[model samples]
Target: MNKAQRLLHILMTMQAHRKFNLKELTEEFGVSKRTILRDLQELSELGVPLYSELGVHGGYQLLRDRMLPPIHFSDKEAVALFLVAESLKGYPMLPFEAEVESALKKFYHYSPPSTKEKIEKLRSHVLFHVQERGLDTPYLTSLLEASLEGRIVTITYEAEKGTSERDIQPIGVYTASGLWYCPAYCFRSREPRLFRADRITALKIVEDQSRRIDPPGYDLRDWFTGRPSGETAELVIHLTRAGAVRAKSDPLLAEGLTVHADGRGCVRRAAAISDLSCLADTLLGYGAKAEVEAPALLREMLLQRVNEIRELYAGAGG
Candidate 1:
C-alpha cells in the first residue's frame, strides 16, 4: 500500500483498537520502526488523534471515544471501488446483499461529485459482461468473513459420490468462469482443496474458541495464477474451412490453429482437452466440419456423447 493508504489504515486501526505500538505497526505494515513513527506524525498532521505513551512498552493510542473522522478516498481508490462493486451487481442470491447495497451507497457518498458524474458517463464507455450461472451463494459472505477472521467452518457439500461433511479453514473466496470457489484447508482431505461454493448445501461456522488460523500471507491470487496440476490430454483435430472460421470466432479454439490452402485446418499445436462432454458438444456443433485426427479415447467419448444427445432428442421427438 502507498503512504496515503497506509496512513489512512493506521488511523482506522488506532481508532478501532485504541492502542498500537511502533513495533506492532511496523510488523503489520512490514515497514521500519522509523517509517511507522513518521507515519504516526503524518497522521497527526492530517488531524488524527495520536497521543503516544512514553515508557518501555509505549505505543500510540487514540483518545478514548475518539472516532476516525470522515476520510477522502483517493481518485484511483474511488474509481476502483466503483468498478469492484459494479462487478457484483447481477449475481444470483449473493450473501449479505443488504451490506453490499450499503457499501455501494457509502462508496458513492465518499466519491467526489465530479468522480461520480464521470463514473456515470464511464458506464457507457466501460462495460463488463458477466454471465451469472444462477448458483445460490448464500454462504459467500460468511465464508469470506471466516477467511478473514481465521475461523473454521463445517460444511455439508454435494459431490459426485454424495453429500459429505468437512471441517475447513478457509483461506479466501475467488471467482472464475461464472462460479464462486473457496480454497480451504480441509480436515477430510488433509490438505488445501477448492470447494465449489454452489455445491455447499449446509454451512455452520465453528465458534469454538480455538480454531486453526490461515497461514500468514496466504493469497488467493497465487492459487489462481499457479499452473494447475490436473491431467490435460492433447487433441489433434482437423477442421473444415467453415469450422476453422467458426473456431476463429472463439479465440480459445482458434489459438494455435493453422489453416491450409486445401480449406482444411489443423491445430498448429495439439489442443489441451479438459472436459470431454464440453469438447464433444462444441465439435458436434460444427457437424461434419470437425474431425478428430488423433486420440482414440477422446473420439470414443465424443461418440458416446453424440449418441446420448441423439437418443435424448429422438425420445423427445417421439
Candidate 2:
C-alpha cells in the first residue's frame, strides 16, 4: 500500500487498539520499524494525542480525548452540516463558538474545489434570519457545564427588580429570539425559575456538595410544546388575518394558535399567571389586530400599560 493509505490504516488500527507498540504496527502493515516510528511521529504531528511509556507494561497509548479518525461525508451531507454551522452565526454567543468556526474552516479547506464553489453559491441564497441582540452571554458555557454535571452555582443576576445573588442548580441553557436563558432550581425561591443568561453579572460553581439541591428532570421540550406546570389560567385571544400571520412567527405563541379557512385565527392556551405581564407586552404590540377574549388579569395588565403610555405622552404634550 502507498504511504498515504498505510498512514490512514494505521490511525484506524490504533483507534481500535487504544494501546499498541511499534513492533505490532510494523508487523501488521509489513513495514520496517523505522518507517512505523516515522508514521507514529507524523500522526503525533497531526494532533493525534499519542504518548509513549518507558515501563515493560507500557508501549504507546492514545489519550482519553484523542482526535477522532477522519470521516467521509457525501456532498449533500457536507452542505447540510455547513448550513447548520452557518445558522449559528446569527446568535451573538455560543458555548462552543471557537470549535464551530474551526470545524467550518476544516470543512472548507478539505472540500473539493467544485464543492467549495457550490457551498459559496448556496451561502448567498440560503439564510436563517434571527434578530440581532446586543447583550453578551459570557456564562453560557459555564451554565451548560453546571447543568450537565448537576452542580450548583451562585450567580449575581440583574433582574427587573434589581441585582441579587442566589444559588441555583441549572436544568439547562437554551437560546431563543437571539438571547440565552437558563432554567434552574432557585434555592432562594425554592422553585424553578428562568434567568436571562446575559443578566448574570457573575457566576461560579458552588463546590460545597452540601449546598446542592436535587433539580427536577424538567424537559426543555415541554417548555416549548406544553403549558407550564402549577397554577395557570386559560387565555383566549381572537386574531385578525394579519395577527394570525404575526403570531405564527412567534415560537411560543404559535404553539397554541389555530387558523381557519377564512384567514382568521385564535390563540387559546393555559398561561401561568406569572407570565401575564410578559404576555401582555407581546400581545400589546399586535395592537388592533388582536383582541383579548378571556382572562381578565391579562386584559387589566394590558389596559394599565396602555394608560401608562397615554399618560407619558400626555405629559410630554403638556
Query: Which candidate wins on TM-score?
Result: 2
lDDT of 2 by residue, 239-291 (tens): 99999998898755787899989999999998877667778878889899999
Query: Which lDDT tens digits does candidate 1 get at residues 1-318?
Result: 988678768877776788778878888999998998888886675456668889998877888765545566777778877777667775665667886786577557546678998778767677676666978878888888878888889999987558899899887887755778888877776666778898998899877837585556766766544433345466688888988887876533565678889877886444334444445656777778888866777688778878988999999999
Q: What is the C-alpha lDDT of each candidate?
A: 0.74, 0.84
Which RMSD values do the candidates have, in order?
10.6, 3.5
The list of candidate 2 runs beyond 4 A from truth reads 1-7, 19-47, 52-60, 209-218, 315-318
Model 1, runs deviating above 4 Å: 1-69, 74-80, 93-97, 110-113, 189-192, 206-218, 227-304
Candidate of highest lDDT: 2
**How much does candidate 2 score in TM-score?**
0.81
TM-score against truth, every candidate: 0.54, 0.81
